[model samples]
Target: MPQDDPRDASLAVKFSPPQTWTAESVDGLATSGMFLAGIIMVTRNRILAWPSLILGVNSWINQHPLRTKEGGTPPVGNLALAFFALIASYLPLFLKATAEPAGATETQTPLSFST
Candidate 1:
């Protein structure tokens, strides 16, 4: 019979899954989604941007430790990054909402110009 090597046990433990998702992983996915949304927004494609923004928001929400139920505290760095990505994903929409329309002209013109 072959004896079990302690080293093999350690190797097996190392290869085992943590069985829990980490905030960093979620944050990374959120960041990627935010980037994709930004790129699509740049092209003025609302259809694509909406889905990307939703993906980023979903990922950011998942970064909370409560979502994992794995007894691990949320990583602050990851939380911050994910929150930033979530906000960024909606930035274009906010800007568009606040922006003047292309056909809009200033109502208050110089008196000389009004004449």
Candidate 2:
């Protein structure tokens, strides 16, 4: 009996083609991306959040199965939810932009410990 080559097995595993994309896989990726965007929003960083927000919106628009095959009508609930999330994601940035600047204050004198 011929012995199996370890190197061959390792190469087979390493060079295997990636799995094909499916609706479920794409949905999971989109969900994860949206979750990351939400985290960035929490940090109040608009610059980073902007790209993430765009990604999230694109994912929703492209991946959502709102349209029906028979009647061709789109489901309103999911569409509404996507819009709501998109709006909510930008709310922090909007609020920050519209916030009033802090008033100027006089600096306090430093205390000396010399006795």
Candidate 3:
């Protein structure tokens, strides 16, 4: 289904909702719903299925951890560690989505971490 839609373009632009929201909106809802469902499933010890689903959801959030000074006032490292775990857990899915295909036209884009 994802392969059918044009990359970076919303499916909503070309179609109207049939007694409900449009396809892109529907896809968005489905993605959100699946993510929540996957989280719930993971918490219940359903690792096999929820891991993949949660990865897609985590990529949607893409939040970065804020590191803090050591031996200062706050436990920023712990917070950052938590954030890293959250991001790491979903990294596989993000990489899969962004990875280039073999023999396909590859774009060399650099990602900036210092902001």
Candidate 4:
């Protein structure tokens, strides 16, 4: 065989055409996470916010930019929303002082007026 041309423009490795990415279960979870994050952000539910946060992180990790359109902010937005939801849910705990100390008893006395 003749020596290979050094200036050949052909790629050594063949790359298949990019196939459009279809949303599957992971995406569904991301969608549900976004929905739950919205609800959590609105309701400030601490219990449900944790799951939304977890799901948002998951979505961010699984995001595929080259395979889909509008790949810019979906994952980042989801994660941010979830983080905000978590913060919103837990922020009140830090805003006000506790009404009572743990295991403390409250004593009340009636006010008296003497004429």
- What's every prediction's RMSD, in angstroms? 10.8, 15.2, 26.7, 6.4
lDDT of 2 by residue, 11-112 (tens): 365454334421223345456555655665466454555555555566656753432234433334334444455566668656746454588446758787
Candidate 3 ranges with C-alpha deviation above 4 Å: 1-73, 97-115
lDDT minimum window of 10 residues, candidate 4: 17-26
Query: Which numbered prediction scores highest in TM-score against the true structure?
Result: 4
Which candidate number maximizes lDDT?
4
Provide the global lDDT of candidate 4 against the true structure.
0.81
TM-score, structure 2 vs. true: 0.35
Backbone collisions counted per model: 0, 0, 0, 0
Would you list the rank order by lDDT, best first?
4, 1, 2, 3
Tens-place lDDT digits, model 4, residues 1-115:
3357645666255666645454322478889999999999788889999999999999899887665555445588899989999999999988978588887668867888999
Scanning candidate 3 in windows of ten residues, the lowest lDDT window is 63-72
- Clash list (residue pairs), candidate 4: none
Question: Mind sharing the TM-score for model 1?
Answer: 0.33
**What overall lDDT goes with each candidate model?**
0.55, 0.51, 0.43, 0.81
Q: Best to worst by TM-score, what's the order? A: 4, 2, 1, 3
Estimate, for each residue in 3-94, the C-alpha lDDT of model 3 and write its tens digit. 56766465547654354221122234334534544454445333333444544445445422222223332223333333444555555666
As a TM-score, model 3 comes out at 0.23
CA lDDT, candidate 2, residue 69: 37
